[model samples]
Target: MATIFTRIVEGEIPSYKIAETDQFLSFLDVRPTVEGHTLCIIKREVDYYFDLTDDELAGLTLFSKRVAQALKQVIDCKRIAVAVLGLEVPHTHVHLIPVRSEQDFHLGRSIEVSPERMEEIAAAVRAALEG
Candidate 1:
């Protein structure tokens, strides 16, 4: 069975996309810790982050950096925090969270964001990436 992230990449599941490349995809986290929390994932179905090859790891990091840069431009935060926890989804992914302080980076908590607001944030990040 394909993981949810793979489903998103395959168009089986809808996502508020922030950015994409031939090998990677970044999109808004529906259950976000913050308003601008995003997920960057490798298109391939890799179970663990450490299981990825050096090149794959580097590519994902570079791809995520671009998304983080764009995310920072649109979201008001001190820094974009990165986290990798593969237990929940069984796919290699990175969380790029916009944080005002250290407390904002907590992975155990999430905030409710409406669909309209998610799209708006996604659009702003996309525009930032493009501009």
Candidate 2:
């Protein structure tokens, strides 16, 4: 079966896409830990992140680096935190979250942003990438 991220890429499921390339896809996390929380996934399905071939792993990180840079331009946080706990879904994915402090990493809770805010954030990220 295709992973949920693949389904999102296929448009079988909807996503608030932030950016994409031939090998990577970045989008907003529905159950986000922070307001600008994003998820970047490799096009291929790997059960674990480290399971990816070295080149694939490098490419994913490179792709996410760009996403993080864009996030920095768009979000108000001090920095973006990357977390790779692969238990949330079966797919190999990276989390890009805006963090003001280490306390923001706690997955125990999440704050939902309104639709207008989501769109505003997306546009800011997009503009950053294009700028």
Candidate 3:
């Protein structure tokens, strides 16, 4: 069976997409740590991030930077923090959070957003990419 991330990549699953290229996709995290938290994933389903090619790795970071900058333009944050913890899904992904303090990126004390809030956040983040 394809992983959930692969399904999203293949459009079998829907997402509040932020940015995409031939090799990467950026979207809002459904269970966001912060209001504008985003998920940046490689097009390929690599379990570990370091398994990606140098070019792919660099491109992913650069692509994420573009999205982070856009998030900053629209979301309130002191800075945008990026985290990589490949334990949840079989695919490699970076979690980008709009942070206000050292604890803002604290994966332990993160906020659980409601579905309605997720929709609202998705709209804002999507607009940020366009704006």
lDDT (tens digit, per residue) of candidate 3 on 96-117: 8998997778665556777777
Q: Which clashing pairs does model 3 show? A: none
Q: Give the TM-score of candidate 3.
A: 0.89
Candidate 3 lDDT:
0.86
Least accurate stretch of 10 residues (summed lDDT) in model 3?
106-115
Tens digits of lDDT, candidate 2, 1-131: 88888899888998788899998899888887889999999988888998999999999999999999999988889999999988978889999989999999877688888877887888789789888
What does each candidate score in C-alpha RMSD? 0.7, 1.0, 1.6
Clashing pairs in 1: none
Full-model lDDT, candidate 2: 0.89
Return the lDDT, model 1, position 112.
98
lDDT (tens digit, per residue) of candidate 1 on 35-93: 99999999999999999999999999999999999999999999999999988999999
Whichever of 2 and 3 has more lDDT, that candidate is 2
